[model samples]
Target: MTSASRTFIDHAVSKVPAVTLGFWIIKVACTTLGETGGDWVTMSLNLGYLVGSLIFLAGFVVLVSAQIRARNFYPWLYWATIVATTTLGTTLADFFDRSLGVGYPGGVSIILLLLITSLGVWYRAEGTVSIESVASARVEWFYWTTILFSQTLGTALGDWVAGEDRGGLGLGYEMGAVIFGAALVVVGLLWLWPRVSRTALFWFAFVLTRPLGATLGDLLDKPVAQGGLEFSRLYASVLLLIFIVGCIAVLPQRAARRASAA
Candidate 1:
């Protein structure tokens, strides 16, 4: 095969885990970390919500740009971008819910709508939303946009479930995590069963990951009074970062598949 052709293949599909069980496990971990870590920088550090959002948003842009510019899939780079998205999601959602006074439900509703719009546009423009076909900038743009929304939506939903009062289900953080996790398992089984639209299943899991992270993160860092461990957010973020980096180094993470057209 020509070097050019080989390169294209490398850029298309990810050579890393294809949203498998391991992938979801790591994804959930990162999301939870995103919650704690994001709060650490924004709330704990006294960065202020606006400042924190700007900081994370900048980081998200930088990491995502780097990921996009990469020659192929680098697990570390890709996952870093994912973590960035989740962190930004946490801050952004909080800003909307608390600062804007939208409340959790309203914030969630808005983000969910945006998320749907992003997916619809992506599908309309690309004719496919499969993770396997993330070959070009256009497709990648859609993928990232959708991801950003999902992460944000997850935070909002987490708050809606665990947040006290205001129509809150008041499930608490741990219970919320369990509920979302169980839902994910059911979705997985349905995904495995034949006759389900693969695309639909993919989106379902993608959306679920965000809330899973949100609730899980809350479970880790919330006070005992609120049903959390009262762990330090900074410590949790740093630890999660370490685990992700170590796993990337040890595991078999491949670069993105090259585009067929490349």
Candidate 2:
């Protein structure tokens, strides 16, 4: 074979799924599961935020290490890593916002700073923040780090919008979900515009979907008096888990292709 052809064939594929409708569907489901699952461990089991964070963080480390070591994309492993991030993000955000008394606004600010810093460092090192660039272990590290921060930020933001105290917007869980969902729709519409930056839109939508899932989770599990269905967190989590697994089993997921050089 020609040297150039060999090089082309040998290029590393991204270890992340292609962006598609199914991708977003599973993402939202996983985020919702994160919320309920985290609550199950922390609130239902009385482990509290700190202990829950530690537990999920351990899982995050394990799964992320496995993801980075894999030579190619494994859909189940990739999605499991995402779930770990979301669950860890939930408890960690709670620890900072509630346990540390930082409040939701403070938590949001801190996490947003972390997210931006991760992205800035990633861009400086890799010259691109696109998911398509996540073809190497180093880039995968940056991707997961950024995702962790985004998930944490989304939890705090969702709580702030839904809560009635600490200068919260008092939208309640249902309304908060509506607002974030609308924002995602807008982001999706922007994706169709030729001049829009897809990388930016993808991240924006990615961040928004977390809070959308968060609020939906809250709506399902919180007390009816608090504008929720008061469903058991364990039950909600199990149902969401089933749905996510089903989607992963049935959906057509493909590893994102590396972008051609401009």
RMSD of each: 2.7, 2.2
Best by TM-score: 2
Tens digits of lDDT, candidate 2, 49-126: 999999999999999999988877799999999999999989988888889898888888888999999999999999
* Candidate 1 residue-wise lDDT, 30-93, digit = tens: 8888899989998899897788889999998898778777765677778888998999999999
* Residue 65 in candidate 1, Cα distance off native in Å: 1.1
Give me the runs in candidate 2 sitting further than 4 Å from their true place: 1-11, 260-262
Off by over 4 Å in 1: 1-10, 15-17, 255-262
The superposed Cα distance between candidate 2 and the true structure at residue 116, in angstroms, equals: 0.6
